[model samples]
Target: MSNLERDPQEIRCGTEAGERSEVLAGREVPLGGPRAMKVSRTLPNVHRRMIGAWCFVDAYGPEVAAMRVPPHPHTGLQTVSWLVEGEVLHRDSLGSLQRVRPGQLNLMTAGRGISHSEESREEVLHGVQLWVALPGDRRHVEPGFEHHADLPVVSRPGFTATVVMGAFGGALSPATTHSPLVAAQLAVDGPAEIPLDPAYEHGLLLLDGEVEPLTAGPLLYLPPGRDALRLSGRGRVLLIGGEPFGEEIVMWWNFVGRSHDEIAAFRKEWMEGEGFGVVEGFDGTPLPAPALPTTRLKPRGRAR
Candidate 1:
C-alpha cells in the first residue's frame, strides 16, 4: 500500500464513509493587517472533502497591501501555504526561514508542535493557508520543512491541474503524510468536464473569477459515487477532498483529535511555559482561544 498508486475507487469509497458536513460559504472576516486584508472561512467545525486527509480550507487574498503577521505556534498539524500573487517570508525556530513567491509552496509540519511567523515582503501578499489534520500516530514526530518551486504543473487537453499534495494527474508533492490526500488547482476556460471516481467525494472552491456549479448554487454537499463533474464559464477552482478517517475526529477551535480530553490536555500545556517548540527570532503572536460551540448538539439537515 505504501508504494502502490491508490485506486481512485478505493479513495472514493473511504470518502463516502467519512462523509460528515459540507461547507457553507460564510461571510468574509476582515483581518486587520498590512492592508485590512479579508479572509473567507469556508469549512469549519464540519467535515471537509475533495482533498486527501485534509479537512480545512481558507483562501487569503489578491491583496493590495503587503500583509505581515507576527510568528505564532502550532502543534500536531501540517500547514500548506501556497502563494497565489505575491511573496511571503516564513521564519521559524527550527532555523528555517525562507521567502516564497507566487507558484511556490511551503509545507511546514508541526510535529510535537512548533512556532513560526509569516510576513509580506516589500509590497502586499496573497495566498491560501490550508490546515491538514495529522493522524494520531504521527502527531508527536519531530518537526520538518519542505519546499517546492515551480512544481511541474499538469495541463491536459481541457484542464490545468496543480498537485500540491498527494498525487493527481501523475504529479505529486514531496511532502509525505499519514493519510492519502490530494490538493489540486484546476483552471478552465469555457466548459470542461472530468470524470470523478465513484469512490472519492469532492468539493470545489471558487477562489477567483466565477464558476457555475453544475449541480446547483448554495450547495450543501456533493455526494459520492458519480461518473464525472463538469465546470464551465471563466474561472478557477480549488479542488479538495480525500479518503475519510474511519473514526470520529474531535475538532475544538484549531485542534483536531480523536479525543476531546487529549486536545484539552495539549491546550493546557500550550497555555503554560511547556511549549513544544519556538520560532527563532519570531515575535510570537498570541494565539486566540478557539470558540467553543454554542451547544453540544451537531447541526442536522444538509449543508446550506
Candidate 2:
C-alpha cells in the first residue's frame, strides 16, 4: 500500500473551526508548458494542511491549451476530478479510459499504487482536482477507477446543487468513496438555502462568484458542526467537507506516504525504476520527483 498509514497520534475528528472563520487565499502555482495553466493550492499549506479527509486541493484554470502530463504514480489517496467547464481525458493503469466533462466526475483510487494521465480535449478547461487520503485498511486495496456521468441534484427557486460524492439533500453519487466525505457543486442565481453535514468540516471555493453577504475573496472555510448556510448571490462554488482525517500523513510530490523513509522509498522506486510499472499506451514524459526536504516529513499516522 505504498506504506501510507494513519498516525497513531489521535487528533479528535471534527475539531471546531473555532470561534473565528477563516478566509483563505490560495497560493498560485503555475503548471508550465505551451499549454501552461495556473492553480491554487488551499490544503497542505503552512496554515492548514488538511480539511476533513481531504489532504490535497488544486483549483485549476479555465485555460485554453493542451495538457502534457503523462502517466504518473499515486498511492494512499483517491483523485477526484470535478470539472466546472471544459473536458479532461483520464487514462489509468487499470485500463480505464474516460473523458470527464462539466458536471461529471472521474474518481481514481490509488490504493496500493496507480498511474494515470490527463489530457485536455477542449480549447478551454476549468476544474478542481482533489485528493482524499485513504484510511489505513483501505490504503492497501487494489487500484481502481470510476466515472459518474449522471449525479443526483437538487433544484430549488434560484438554487441548484449537484451531489458529486456522498449523500446530500437525499441525493447520493454512484462513485465509490473510501471515507465519509461530501463533495458538491453549487450554483446560486439569487437567494439559496443549502443543507450541510453537521458532522463534517466544510469549505467553499468560488469558481466564479461569492457566498451571500460574506466579503471573502474566493475561499471560505466553515468548521464542523454547521447545519446549513444561506446563499443570496449569483455565482458558482464547490462545497467539500467530511469527517476530519484524525491521523497525520506525509506527502511529497505525487506520492503520499506514512513516513519519511517510506516516501523516500517510493520516490526511489519510481525514479529508479523499481515501483509503479509502465502504464501501457501512455506516450509522454512523466514528471520527475522533487528532492526531499532536509527536515524529515511530519508524522501523521502511526508508523508502519
Candidate 3:
C-alpha cells in the first residue's frame, strides 16, 4: 500500500470526545478482495495520538473468509501481525516465508523499505494487523522479520496477558522493539488487576467482552499514568502502552515517513521498482503503488 489510494472510511476521530471514555467506531475495508472486514482504527484519531511507538492499529476479524493480500510495500515502521484465530502465510522481499498461527506474533520491520504479502486459504480466518513507528535512530537501520512462537505472559487470578512486545509484570518479551512499549493480549474471565508502567501512556481495546467503565464498541483511552487497573469482565482485551513517543510522524497508507516529500519519493520508488524490491514466491504480481498526491501532501503528527 502506497501513501496514495487510502480508503475514505479511515476517518480521523472527532475532537469533541468526552474526557473519561471515548468509544470509537470502525470502518469496513475489503482486506481480502471483496470480502468486507471491519477495522477498528485507533491512532491518528482526534481523542488521542500515538500510544508510545504504536502509530496504527487495525483490529479485523472473528468473521470467516480466505485472506489474500497481494504483495505490498511498507517503510519506517514495524508491522505486527497478531493472529487471534486462523493461520497466515507471510512472504517478503527478503525471501522470508513463514506461516503465522493463532497465538503467534509475526513482526516485519520496514526500516528503509520492504515488499511483502499475507495470504490464507483457510475458509475461516481472524486476526489483527498493527503498525509501530520506528524511532529516528532505527527508522532506516535495515529491513528484518521475526516470528515468535512463545512470548512472556503475566497471569493473575482471572486474567492472563501475553506480552507481544516490551515488558509487563516483570516479564519481558524476546520480541525486538526500538523503544519502550508494551503490546499484550489479555484474556479475562472475571475481575482481575493488571499492572501498568506509571511512566507509560496506555489504552484498551475490548476485543471480545466489555470491561467495567468500557463498553465493547471502541478504543478506550485509559486515564494515563495509572499504576494498575482492575478490569472486571468476561472477554478479551488488548493492552498497548509506551513511554510517550516524542517525535512527530507522518503516516500515509502503509508508509510512515517524516515528511510528505519522503512519502512522495518512496511512492515514486515503489512504482518505478527502484528501491522497494519484489517479493519472492508471492501468489501474484504485487499491487501497484497508488498515484502520488497532486498537491504537496500536508504532514500530520504531534507537534515537535
Q: In order, what is each prediction's RMSD in angstroms?
A: 7.8, 5.0, 3.2
Q: Write the per-residue lDDT of candidate 3 for residues 211-234, one digit (tens) a residue.
A: 775666567665455888888978
Best lDDT among the predictions, by candidate number: 3
- lDDT tens digits, residues 1-304, model 1? 0001111111110223334435455435555443557766554423333244555555666667655565455666788887778887788768898888777778888777676677665555556777776776887789888788856588765678787777677777676766776677777677777545555556666766766663212223445666467777766667665554443455444455555466666667666746656556655554434433334422121122
Candidates 1 and 3 compared: the better one by TM-score is 3
Model 1 scores worst on lDDT over the 10 consecutive residues at: 1-10
| lDDT score, candidate 1 | 0.59
Give a tens-digit lDDT track for model 2, residues 8-60.
11111222235345676777666545446767776655446567788777787
In candidate 1 the C-alpha lDDT for residue 6 amounts to 16
- The prediction achieving the highest TM-score against the true structure is 3
* TM-score of every model versus the real structure: 0.78, 0.88, 0.90
Assess candidate 2 and give its lDDT: 0.73
TM value for model 2: 0.88
lDDT of each: 0.59, 0.73, 0.74
Candidate 3 versus truth, CA RMSD in Å, comes to 3.2
